[model samples]
Target: MSADRSSGGGVSRRQLFGVLGAGAAGAVVGAAGGAGVALAATGGGTTDASGAAASVYPYFGAHQAGIVTPAQDRLHFAAFDVADALDREGLIGLLTEWTDAAARLSQGLEVAEGGAVGGSDYSPPTDTGEALGLPASGLTITFGFGPGLFTDESGADRFGLSARRPAMLEPLPRFQGDALVPEMSGGDLCIQACADDPQVAVHAIRNLSRIAFGRASLRWSQLGFGRTSSTSTTQATPRNLFGFKDGTANVKAEETAIVDDHVWVHASDEPAWLAGGSYLVARRIRMIIENWDRVQLGEQEMLVGRSKGEGAPLSGGTEFTEPDFDKTGATDAPLIDADAHVRLAHPTSNGGARMLRRGYNFVDGNDSLGRLDAGLFFLSFQRSPQQFIDVQTSLARDGLNEYLKHVGSAIFAVPGGVAEGEFVGQALFA
Candidate 1:
């Protein structure tokens, strides 16, 4: 082994956490007429009107931080497939290494002490140098285990962990209008890296992918910008490529009771290892923006069931006002269209189930037809996969589906948070 890693030089967790906001101190130094120091030191004690925390979120928590943390501006989401040559122990080793790296990176420190520079010049650096001068920017790296992690497509227990798989962790059923590409969907594991800065988010995924060099390989990845949902009430709802305010009715982090009921896997739930965990569903929905742009604004609003200006229900009232599905217009027809997205995706229409969504808008350049290959990269967390299933099934009739195509999809069992001494998903291995 090389002294580069075997020498064991890195910042300690206590030193990292107790430093009065060491994570983002660099970025806030001269902000807000010097109030930046307090903001940085206090782990973003100051908040704007939207209630968005200005900096740093603790990496260690009861549940993973990213799901409920205020939505960040950018995302780098990557899914990985375990290498066939890697065994169960190698998987555990890779996870352990990833946990340590995640803790350091989330705190705005390098992967190790020598980091991108200080180490011997003879060997490759332990941490990539791209993020050397960046702040934490509220970066969070969340891990998940997909169905194939435990068992192969042939149903062979690859890691001797098939018995521990969550019952709902199966591959998602194909729904209506699915034009999924095989290479773009599914993985044995996944990492979601989110941050206010695009480079910081990319750095996280890059380093993590490097760490998994031999154990696993990237299956698919998506880079997204301009968050499409707000996970906290303090954060304003953001719009998608379609230009309507999205996630107005989404579950907020402040709604503790609702979160417990709808987002987290309860202790009483089956599979004790995933007690505090949650299930995640990711979908790549390519929007037909060209066609959508040609539709009259009023017609677009009708399909969404909200005013284009204020995102208010067409039936009347403010953006936050509960939608009225039965209110009729002058022509004696319902104000909200029968197949409106708001009506179909609403909790009332989906067995009272809700998901904590933290999606992003993506523009992956252009297609062969000269159309912009852009859309929404949808991400949601729920207590069970069935919640998403029901909601998506109801969207079978959504008017918005005509302008949208489901291109990629995957579901993962996100295990509970890591303890100080434990690696992520340690309980599963135990």
Candidate 2:
């Protein structure tokens, strides 16, 4: 009950970085401290791994609105650079490992008395996410593997699981060489596990990373979304990031009929495995909580579709509760701010299409530069990026854009899952 940031047998706050666990914002901690340390652990010398770092990422989710939110906040993300030699054989081995790891997480693991596994080895975070207002997240774990993960044919190894294709997002202003976000940028990690108990999340990720990458290295981290529940929520959730319940505006798979009519495109060109999969990951987010908290309790209620304490739509009820869009002038009354993020991403407005969002907040180190780092990794899964594209294009011009910034971005074309010994995109490339 003590902050829950620490579990019962949790490692002393001392070990929160390595052996303990970092949060979504700061997980990028090195297995030791900086990327140099991480590189050293995996064979320090650089091997002429260079390329024209693309100035613009294709189909990035930067400007895309987020559907998942703080209530859905318990999450972690890790991005890794895969060792080369990833071919049909490597993919086979990789997927097999995924199936195995998924099995263990689904069943649960031996949680340390502190709720995390004990005796694990990792350096301590030089700093907890003080600027971010959240204690380091406990259990959440996320995964990312670089492009080489799938494309590299050499013996280079991967750090974790990856989306395998480029993603698209609208670009934002660039950072000077000293920015912290460049450090928090994307790649791949093995898994993302969030939970009520930080210890449970740590325990889950530690084992999950061990199994997926042989050794899980810390990378990028942060804490967000405060929830009343044990889930240790963060602003990463869909609703509150923009100061309102965000994802309620999204569409679900079961509601595919409606989605097909609006959001999705089942073209004859696409193959079968992608049939059920939808494209377009909308990631509209903001940090109005600070502002919301400032408003009179009653005023906050009228501004959002839900209540502050309950998180339910203003029409009535508790969190995870339904929103009453039908409250007549409630809609026209602009009870919800006109420029509010929720107002932009709603189904009645721009959310006619939906993307499966899977991302976490990130908080990296502060250097001689003026401050620390903060923002969301904001990821989405869709059959095509188009669905997400339309929604984001709408938000890019909305009111919520003031607080949030579209920083790092990239677009990856995820290929189909492989069959026996085939690399993921063997059908297209081979």
Candidate 3:
């Protein structure tokens, strides 16, 4: 990819998450300054349905997020479609319109809203490894969906495209063609947004949500939140409800790994309009942390591969330190087993297709519960889902799975960013 993907069809590696600070350690970085990364002057100040900027970066080129922080800076997440609507063509059209809307949000001040169509050919998934190389602390988006998104039941308009919005639908997304509860694992409409100031993030999203609803004619959607807490730093790595330090062992961006080839599709193989860009999204899966805290610390470590207090490997090693995968705890002890959560999430195994994770802690509730609504709006990105699924599935049945349920999910095909015209994926569907 080119040095500054920031200028064109998709988000530049620089603008995206774990956006590495301007240094070699390549620690995670977030948009630190500037008037949202500006796209080439193509139009004028725009307004959204709620009168906010029409679109946001990683989806809309309207604003470039300055930096990412645990304080919750930018929204992170993905959305999926019910089986009935997420077919190959439908998926294509959906994103096309999203990008088109983003362009419209740009209002020609950036790139023309929508123009090209991607070819139906075999291609690799996206390379989130590149994301780790950028920086660990920044706002980035990732998209992924569960298998159930495609199903809808009798008289239920889960697809939303239905001519008759079904009454029996009960205003919820579906999985396996059945009516899903509010916390459906995979969502037809998913929107995850984060910002240092919770209110700013919410306001920004309300505008974007309004725009999306207006253009696509979408009904209600599932909104999830991931927050970074400055209140507590004793927790070495961040965590979700399961109380495990989620995403501690994934690969870092800029790290050399074959996983890149396996996950991401190269720009050379795609259309010219798409050059140095990639799609991104995030999912906020709320965790039941209080319940997690009740589990024995030893058992918790077994599930997360580290002590919750230190984020260190259960066998040994400090937070941010390399784990001793080879060390057996005792003469007959199984130290770091292959199936361990941290072990599986470790980048060394599975072609190293480890995803880069940067999420936060959010607290919401009345004084009655005295509890914070915390969980990872588990955010991540990939050129494809196969490998990510492989590793994730293994962890799902692992020790910590029960404490956490996959609540919200979404998937979007991000187009590469090119310069000569508008953002990729805009023209075709619009």
Per-model TM against the reference: 0.89, 0.50, 0.55
lDDT winner among the candidates?
Answer: 1
- For model 2, residues 7-87, the per-residue Cα lDDT tens digits are 122234444344334323344210000111112111111212221110111111211111111123344433443323334
Worst-scoring 10-residue span by lDDT in model 2: 29-38
**Candidate 2 deviant stretches above 4 angstroms:** 1-25, 28-73, 85-88, 109-180, 188-190, 212-243, 252-338, 356-379, 407-430
TM-score, candidate number 2: 0.50
In model 2, the Cα lDDT at residue 412 comes to 36
lDDT, each prediction: 0.81, 0.37, 0.39
The total of clashing pairs for model 3 equals 75
lDDT of 1 by residue, 1-430 (tens): 1012232333355533432231110000001101121222112323344322235667766787688777788889988888777788778778888888898898888987788999898777888899988777778899999999989999999889999998889999989879998677998999999887788888998888777765677788888888888776666677888989999999877787888899999988979999889999999999998999999998999899999889999999999999989899899999999999999999999889899998888888888999988898999999999999999999999999899999989999998887786788888988
Candidate 3, superposed: residue stretches over 4 Å from native: 1-192, 217-236, 241-244, 254-264, 268-286, 337-339, 360-374, 418-424, 427-430
| Candidate 1 clashing pairs, residues 3+ apart or interchain | 50-234, 51-234
Distance from true position, residue 413, model 2, in Å?
6.5
lDDT (Cα, 0-100) at 159 in candidate 1: 85
